[model samples]
Target: MSYRELIFTVPAEIAEPLGDALLELGALSVTVEDAAAGGYDENPLYGEPGLSPEVQAWDRSAVTALFNPEIDHSGEANFIPELLASLKESDFHLAQPSEKIVEEQDWVRLTQSQFAPIQIGKRIWVVPSWHEKPTDPNAICLAVDPGLAFGTGSHPTTHLCLLWLEQNGDLENKSLLDYGCGSGILAIAAAKLGCNPVVGTDIDPQAMVAARSNAEINHTLIQFILPNEDAPELAADTKYDIVMANILANPLQVLAPALVNKMRVGGRIVLSGVLARQADEVIATYSQWLKLSVWQESEGWVCLHGELLSAISNEQSNPSHIESIATPQKKRLKLVLLSLFFLVLLVFAEHLSRNSLLPTLATRIDGTSSPIAVSAFSLLQKTDEILCRSLRCINRSVSDFTAWKINSASLAQESSGEPLKIPANQSKLQVEIQNRLAIPVLFPYLELTLTDAEESEIKTIQFSPQEWLPISWQDSHPLFLLRGAPSGESIHSELAFVMPQNTAGYRVRIFYSH
Candidate 1:
């Protein structure tokens, strides 16, 4: 028998979900790896250390999934196409993935061969259950399975943390807390090294389970709990002699106050999973309660060590500063308001994308955008008959709506009717606008949005046909002036306007005004 493997390469944001989607579609197994692994761009993901993941850090990720041909399904020959169709229904737009056939083999043994006894620092060694412990009696083997959680003493981030623990020699009776204790590797090693009352905490429940199991295999008495646990020893009032955290930079800064609060005065703190360049910022973030310095550097990653010599102000350590789902009334109110603001923007974006509305270009502008605003406000106050005569009217039915829509539009520097001057910052907007309906309709308004290099809105302006249409063209087509562009007729016109300062991009949309 043989297994079918399908592989896909996609952006980092889509990798994890794609893997899970494959699993839900009956894949036997799925694996995700950096698409650029071993290259200069490998795993170039970085975020300020914090609780949430920074998926934007990496450019691309590779995902591979295996399927058993014998599993009940449609035709085996058409299995891949059918699976892809199911994936599309689940909102994953993907191309045909690369495929391969794997003959049956001892997968478990093959996987076990990849993980061997890895000795870290002087006294600690990470040994998979399938491998024997090191011969050295001093070697403290942590029975952690590779990939069971996140850490297994192989990655540089994990290795650096282990080495730091080893150098701390004689931790007997000293309390240590392993923040984000994946697989409980650090907590178990600290326990064996004589640390009393070792504790580990992670947000992921699965990590908590894997960590507890690993601690038991190592025969270490480590208290493993989730961040939300009510364990008395990990209450708000509880503090540790030493605090260690190995997470990305973004989360580190975000959790600075909480992590620092976990340490007793004068207690040491160790932070790993930080890039070399982000050291200063991380140090600055924790400077309020402690002084952190680079303890060691390996493979562009650094382990930070610090001593908390002073107490943080009550305001700095307030519950608001810490991450929690239980937010204060005021904060929740602010969150609701923020959500509403974004919702309004989304509704407008759709309307703006499909159609546009504007009053008119100001008759005069001597280096000022005030006239555009003035004209717009004036149009709003105008009588209904006047407004309809100046701009297009909305409120068309379904079939009529589709028939009358903005076609294509473009914005560029003015190139005709004599050279344009730079002092005015002028540009020409060309739109192929028309109404396909059998009856004539009012000319639509043109709304232009100017944005900066970062795509942030700088200014917005709307124009009526009389304000933007060329005087020469209006004279050439007498009927268009009286009856709006006329039915089945296309009006390809250039609208010129003064660009706002720092304008780097823009959007042009034409739509009937309600």
Candidate 2:
């Protein structure tokens, strides 16, 4: 089947009336675009949320209407002239009307051909209903088809987000909240990865329906609901372990506070649907409550990942100090005196028992620490274990450790066509680091590994501050002398790897020892 497409360049004032006039004159479909597209006078029209209806169309509009080729006007033996006469009589004049023959094709097959099984990271695959599941038996296949919703894993923004989730492991037992969950792909992926109690919210009722259907097909338990303006609650009195929002930059900025309030302390967030240039703006918006940075980039799109920071995390890291401040003055003094007396008694007992009871008492004190303190101490203790397991280094005491925190960290591949040329045997890896702590500490050493989609380590590289650094401080100090970076500082560093073939992603483990 074929059709005739009638195109007209009309002023914005009459575009709507002209479109209605065309439709009343027996047009199949009408579409509009900017007449000055690709020219200096081009006007870009954006339909942002809360935008007025007047701003939806361009100043100079090009309207195209489709019609069946079989339509005839044999009264005068000419169809174009007769149609023009009719439109002019109806007070809708198209000065110059253009006609073109539009060939028709199998739109269903064509649309289906445009989509295939998209592989995200190693374990996750977004497969359309018509497509076969990936051959990998262990793959977490999501049965999603194109619908009225937005995401289908073909867009670079969604791809970047899926890759982030796959590379960041151990989501088991975590809770997730997916805002603007078009098609609910991210929320379902989290559920498949072992995150329980997953919830997806969207403003569109159709999107909520589609997400629910998709979740049912995937056999993942996900709760899909419309955004409740009155009570926007996830779990009552509970914060989410992971929150994902793959929305545009403006909405992301507007929802920053709401999203932050839903996240537990130290919980992770993944944001996409942002351009590489807009990544900084988005990060700055979320920087107040969440430390966000670009985690990955595909083509020109960027994915930002961050963790929630609050007074709870700070208190958890230093329970004893917090307890001192929170406790009454008299109780604090009594505790100090009791601690001193216990120290004296332990010293005497150690002298008498010849160190037999010293180890037991130390173990008891360590075990009696608060859960947050214990977790922090365990992470600190793992420094020696990590070094011993992978790279060899001297074990140091935790007391020497500075309070420097990893407010934002990102691991991404260098863009192609970088000015710096890499050797034939090496590949480029870029690391973005931000310090959110009040005081700066020495440059922390990092251990980076290039891994394939399957997460198998292909190559391991240990980096210190002395290595090839991109940003330099005015008063740079030696690596051994723990450099002091002022609060809210960022650094970028690049390193060349031994060019591991088939490398899909990277895993970075930072080892900070002062």
Candidate 3:
């Protein structure tokens, strides 16, 4: 259930305090604009119906603030009741205005437990968390969960193409792409089918994260990119051997030109996400851009496959094709060498003139240069190997260290049907903090707990923090060593054993930094 705005015409003096109290009560965001000062746009995209049949001067003077108490249709009727009580307690006098702004209750559930995995083809499965992984060896596995936006791979359009891929031409050595990739399933499937350098693009960052995580889980080397519809840089100007899009009809129309441009001259394209009724419209949109070939239709979904046709005129008299002539000019090799020598001499003379004959005195910064130089010189090709091994270790340590006070960590564990708990007030300061242990950990089986000085349990530990780091433990357990630079973009974690809670302050762990 979303929130509603409570429009009250109160005196200007009490508006600020009233808004604050309402916020404290549970409003998500509040805005107080001068209604009396007219000419301001009220929601540029959507225009709300007027509050009353006839506008009152009070409605213009009073601040209309929106509150999201997380109420539903059944709960909205109680708003005036609570407002009346709050008014009486605040000792404010008010009257009902001429108009009422009533919004239909729309129940949106952010919790995604009801969504299940989707079966694309006979052997391809897109298993979201709500369903179990398919046991069939032939099933191509895809682990993901959709939030807010679309793409679970169960849609008719996605299934239609998956079926086609399962029955179609060889995917080996083919460069593939998933344009408007919602969850990157198609792109991942291509990589799993032996396509090299599979690429996926979406408009959402959250979707990109989900896609990357899914790719990692599936062990597919697909690169997912979040590209703006208007920007070309985000969608690197490169061609692919095979491209597929499961996006809708309208965007598909606009995407045809861009997508066709991305395909190699004779490369294939698979376009889904169109209704059966809209298939002809989609076909017509792409026909002008590419030479439309065979199409596959299943369960009212259409997947168009085609080779790109040259837009250039195919008629004769255009010289059929243009050719390049590389004619070398005759020259004296000795004369060219002499010219190069003179140029080098001129450059060296200029360099000598730019620098002083004597060495200038300089201040030397400590430590920064060597470490920075070493890190910069390290081969980037091995960064992933380092990250995966180190992150796995950090995750293990965090799991072995503590479990309480961490609410909603990104490290997803298998459903044990038991809530993770940590002892509270345990003198164990470091290991007792739960949230501190969560962001650094990334495995599914590890657990953390808190114990006392005498190894007794106390209150359940609770913890929360905006950021954390995973510091890699060296070969030994007691000593910890840092591998990479302290990165704000990536999280780092460390482990600690704690005593059962007693509200004891925490001491920092000392570690060597590279």
Best by TM-score: 2
User: What are the root-mean-square deviations of the candidates from the true structure over C-alphas?
Assistant: 18.8, 21.3, 25.8
Question: How many residue pairs clash in model 1?
Answer: 13
Better of 1 and 2 by lDDT: 1
Best-to-worst TM-score order: 2, 1, 3
Score every model by TM-score. Answer: 0.53, 0.57, 0.41
Better of 2 and 3 by TM-score: 2
Residue-level error in angstroms, candidate 1, position 247: 2.2
* Ten contiguous residues minimizing lDDT sum, candidate 1: 359-368
User: Which ranking of candidates, highest lDDT first?
Assistant: 1, 2, 3
By lDDT, the best candidate is: 1
Per-residue lDDT tens digits for candidate 1, residues 1-514, read 8888777656566878888899988888898876557743244443343433445323446688988878845227787668777887888766445567789989899989999888887778888898877899777888889765889888888999999989988688989999988888888888888888899999888898899888887888989888776898678778889898997787888888888888898788999988898898889988867788999999999999998886655554576765533456668899999999986775444334322222122111212224555565344334333545665556322212323444445455674432222233677766665565434456666787766645578788898767766677688877654466545566677777876656645555555567
Error of 1 at 425 (Å): 49
- Compared with the true structure, what per-residue lDDT tens digits does model 3 show for residues 253-278? 87777888788767888888776777
Which regions of candidate 3 fall more than 4 Å away from where they truly are? 1-113, 129-131, 228-237, 293-301, 309-317, 321-514
